[model samples]
Target: MLTPIPLLIIPLAIYNIIAFLTPGVAWTSGLAEIAMMSGVRWTLTVSDVFLALCLFVLLFEVMKATRISSRSIVDHILSLLLFVCALIEFLMVPQAGTSPFALLVAIMLLDVIIGFSVSIRVAQRDVALTAAPDQ
Candidate 1:
């Protein structure tokens, strides 16, 4: 049920909401500044935060893909659809033309590829195990 829902959509939807609701918001604008030990300052921007969150969600998405079930198949299909939509948005929409959005699209694409590859590998292993000759 819930397992079929692609987790990557959360960051995509958040980006959409922020981009649409807040015009003139600079993705590169620093959200926080950390003083480094080398007497320098490291600035963390909105884009950095978004990318980090997407990666965290991706970890769970990959874990979910490893489960062999009908829900996982649906998840892979939905993830593929999500990647297509994100890629189209990145290409066609002005608001989605930022580097952060592009990275999100890339993450979604990775999720789809990983999901399918893992599913195929697991299915092959299962087939091999079940098709063993009688001793």
Candidate 2:
């Protein structure tokens, strides 16, 4: 039951909650600054952190795609739907117009593409193996 649900949706909901509930928050504002040994200061902003979280979720999404099952098909469908919804919001919604949100949408799209592609490839391999003659 839980397998059909897209994991990336969690980050999407979190982004929406942050955007709509706290309008004053800035994505570009630095969340942390780390100084390197070479005297370089690296600033990690809200946008960077959000995008990193999305990417982490994406890694899990790809891993989940490796399993061949009925639930995985449903998962791919839901992931595609999620990508469409996110794309729509990125294009038409003011709050979602930021670079971080745009990248999130792109990551969702990648998730859908990778999910479907991997499923098909794995399914093909399984079919081929099953059809092979006995030694």
Candidate 3:
């Protein structure tokens, strides 16, 4: 079973690769390259799609992390490690160091932090509940 935290990488990697390979066209990539509808021009870029994906994964991570269990701890820890990797990659790799990608990395970092905090809160609540005196 794959956790949401690690799943964050797929979108990030896809976005970075597409962005890097494309020669700064200032337009969309893949099938949805360009669009014209309702007298408005729009384009769907890799970063745009992947950012949404990362956000969706963040929601799942938050839900799973807030669950009261030991695995939640491991999930958040792995998330933090992945966050560090993303941060380093964004900082050191020119190809992947775009503003949009950096923003995504920031969002992923937030997921790690929130996941750990939420897990801790949930774990504390579980301990308190189990330790409560029964009649």
Candidate 4:
């Protein structure tokens, strides 16, 4: 029973790590190359990174609003749906010059780590919430 908060944060943390290791400039270059090969002329600017960060924050807010509980069947289904969609997107997207196998492995690893972390966090939160106050 992974919680959503940790589920989201772990991936963001991994992204931050990757970003730090590669830096924005190099990332942009790689993105540009891929985009060019895909016939997508999108510019990989600082704004793109900013936009991603903003989206991540928005996702976190959504997760907070929809607090997960063990009884939330809908939440579980929705999470599964999201995972499926992400898998489809990763598989269908053009890899261009990038190594598809490596990208897939990384994406899968990220998904697993985030999912597990979130489940644990959610379970912990549920316990804390249900705990009775000390007199």
lDDT of 3 at 101: 76
lDDT of each: 0.93, 0.92, 0.72, 0.46
Q: Candidate 2: worst 10 consecutive residues by lDDT?
A: 123-132
| Local distance difference test, candidate 2 | 0.92
Q: After superposition, how far is residue 125 of candidate 3 from its true place, in Å?
A: 1.4
Tens-digit lDDT string for candidate 1 (1-135): 356899999999999998999978899999999999999999999999999999999999999999978889889999999999999999999999998999999999899999999999998887743567899
Choose 1 or 3, whichever is better by TM-score. 1
Q: Which candidate comes out best when scored by lDDT?
A: 1
3 versus 4: better lDDT goes to:
3
For all predicted structures, in order, the TM-scores are 0.92, 0.92, 0.72, 0.33
**Model 2 residue 46 distance off true place after TM-score fit, in angstroms:** 0.2
Model 4 misplacement above 4 A: 1-51, 58-72, 95-135
For every model shown, the clashing-pair count is 0, 0, 0, 7
Worst 10 residues of 3 by lDDT: 25-34
TM-score result, candidate 3: 0.72
Over the stretch 1-135, how does candidate 2's per-residue lDDT look in tens digits?
347799999999999999999999999899999999999999999999999999999999999999878889899999999999999999999999988998999999999999989998998877744467889
Q: Which is superior by TM-score, 2 or 3?
A: 2
